[model samples]
Target: MIKLGILFGGRSGEHEVSLVSATAMIHAADKTRYRIVPIGITKKGDWLLYDGPVEKIADGSWEAYALDCLQKDPARYSIAILGTGGRSLKDTADFIIPAVHGPYCEDGKLQGLLDMADIPYAGSGVTGSATAMDKIIAKAIFKDAGLPVGPYVPVMAEEFRRDYPAVKARIEAQLTYPVFVKPANMGSSVGISKVNDGSTLEAALEEAARHDRRIIVEQGIDGIEVETSVLGNYGDLQVSCVGQISYTADFYDYEAKYQNEDGLTLTIPADLPEEITAEMSRIAKEAFLALDCCGYARADFFLEKGTNKLYLNELNTLPGCTGVSMFPLLWKHSGLDFTQLVERIVELGYERYSITHRG
Candidate 1:
């Protein structure tokens, strides 16, 4: 049996969400096939083995039961992978499932550490994860691939603070109202705002800047928010059924996404013309390979209502996975349940690791 370390929770905005994903994953891994080691990361970012019964996954209840947390016994805890890496139980781990999302954990920071430790892990490598994390960079890559992408302007925090008016003016000139102001390095819509006018734009920019040094203001597309999940290593990949997200609000911000669902509706296997679905899957696969992403990625896009134009949004190397998240949901729609999905990812990670680390 493979000793699998399920890494979850971290110093990311989606930390609470990670807890939910991790809990679901732990419950799903086949006990007879794999021995599981549950590793949790505190909001402050400390990695440790949490000792507690799994209950209703809380968004933010136990930060890291420091005092009650399990003490690292060499025999039980295993070595720390010898370097900064996914602190998986090095005793064995044929594979590691990183149920972590957002910055510090998903942005290749943790992936790089894992790479150096010589441990196999699910999802993209350092470069791929970092590239996918920054919307500005990822969008640029998509555009260069000749994929139709919406126009976006990047505003550095330093630049935004130095001359707010000039930056705002440039944005106003290039994009119309109803643009999305977002932190370049965030996920789960934690620091995103849809601005309609200069007043909202200013607040949006300021709010976005608080999350990251770089901000991205993307031109809005009049379409439904549909997303597809891509899986594989480099050349060989598959795109799952497309799903449409309907937010109660004009946009699917954090509130509508996790907290409140007043205006949130999820349509699995989105009812689209066969051709459109084919096209979305094709473009999504191309984008995934274009970025050299391995294992899995959630390709988000905009399907403008009347015009029928599809604009590729950036790909998420490590997407949200809180059971209710789009990645697992889309795959579930594609016939891979949460358990199979986790197992598949771990297998993919091992397969990729064998080839790449085979030197």
Candidate 2:
């Protein structure tokens, strides 16, 4: 059996969410073909080898049973697990699935580490992860690729703090009311706010700045929010069915994503014209390649209500992996179940590893 490593619960605001996604993956992964090794990274950035019940991993009680498993020695390629006789060595995982989200892990930090060790991992690499994590950079890449994107203004934390009035004035002058203020590098809508007018703009910017040094304010589009999942290496890509999220919250926020179970509604194969769906698929693939993303990504789009104009929102290299999450649901409708999808992701990871490491 292939030794499959599942890395989750990273140093991110979405740590708890990562636990849930990793739990779902562990439960759904094929046992006959793979042996699962659960590695839990605590909020404090401690890496531990967990050999507890999968359920405990979700609730986070697994930390009590985890063995400190940091690789302090560069010569040791395999993980060092603590056993009764002291520390024992375990073979390097044949393939590692990084289920971590947000900053420390998703923003290329962890991917860079894995690359240094020459390890195979599922999902995007350093460049793709870094670019996709920053909204401003991704928007520039999308715009350069000739993809349609909404207008947005980026402000550095220092710039906003030094002269709040100037930055606020710039935002007000460039974008109209009802703009989205968000941290440039956060995901799962962790630090995002919808400002209706100038009165609440500064506070919204402050809230976003709390999470990231760089913030982006985008002109709100009156459109339907739709997402499509893309998979595979650069040349050969697979685009999944479009999924629409209907949420009652101000927008798709952190609470709507992980908490408040019924706060949002996700419809697979979103009710859109054949042409629109095709366009979303086309753009999704284009965005995936444009961002240099490999393995998998979920491309969100804003379909203008009246004009039917499609605007690229952002690309998430490591989207949520729960069975019911939009990414998996979109793929499920596209003919791959949860188990098969995970297997396919691991396969793609291997494929990417081969191509990238080829000497």
Candidate 3:
């Protein structure tokens, strides 16, 4: 059986979300075909080889058990990700599936390590992952590719700190009130705030700065939010049916996404004119190819309420895989079940690796 490593938990604001995603993936993964090797990374960046029941993963009880095992039997439970020989991550698993999200896990750091170790892993490579993670960079790339993106202004944290008034004025000049202030490199809606007016802009910018040195202030779109999933490598891609998100919050904040589930409703095969769905699928594939993404990604879009003008929002190279995440649901609606979806992702990883490593 192939030793499949499922990496979960990360040094990111989305750490808890990763745990939930990992748990779902572990449960869905076929046990007979692959030897599941669960690897947990703590908030402080400690890597532990966990062998506890999968049920303990989602609620975070597995961490304590893994830590105890590590202390009692360091050689067996400890993980030397970069170390040589049998204990290293490269030697432990033939293929790795990163069930983690956000910064360190999905921003290309872990992918880079895997590349260096010559290990095949699911998801995009360094350039695609890093570019998709940074909103500023991704928007620039999209605009360059002739894709319509919502108006946004990038801010440097140092510049804002040096002269708050000047920075605020610049933002005000470019965007009206009710702009969204967000860390350029964050997911799960962490460190994001909707500023209705100047009175609250400073606090929003400051909060964003705490998460990343780069910040983005975007013109709030009064539109319906839609998303589509893309799978497979370049030239042989599969775009799933579109999905829509309806929420009661001011925006689809972290609370609406994961917590306060009552406030949100997800509609697969989003109700839309056939032409609009086709256009969205076309744009999503273009954006995925523009970033040189492989394996899979979810592209988010905004459809203006009145004009029906569509703007490509952002592509999540490593979108959430939890029970409620749009990426998996979109595929499920497209006819692939949870197990089949993950199995396809692993096949794509190995396929990409083999083609790239060919002499």
Query: Highest lDDT: which candidate?
Result: 3
**Candidate 3 colliding pairs:** none
Per-residue accuracy of model 2 over 1-359 as CA lDDT, tens digit each: 99898998998888988998999999889999999988888889867776668999888887766642233432332345322222332254657898889999999998888887677899999999999999999999999999999999999999988998999899889889899999999898888999998888888888998889999999999988999999899979989989898988877788888777687899887989999999988988988998899999999999998899999999999999864579888888999988999999999999998998998
lDDT against the true structure, per candidate, is: 0.83, 0.87, 0.93
Off by more than 4 A, model 1: 56-66, 71-89
Candidate 1 C-alpha lDDT tens digits along 167-266: 9999999999889999999998888998888888888888998889889999988899999999899888988999989876768888788777656789
Candidate 2 lDDT:
0.87
Better of 2 and 3 by TM-score: 3
For 79-119, candidate 3 gives per-residue lDDT tens digits of 67876877889888889999999999888899999998899
| TM-score, per-candidate, Cα-based | 0.93, 0.93, 0.98
Candidate 2: 10-residue stretch with minimal lDDT: 81-90
Provide the lDDT at 27 for model 1.
Answer: 89
Best by TM-score: 3
**Model 1, 5: alpha-carbon shift in Å?**
0.9
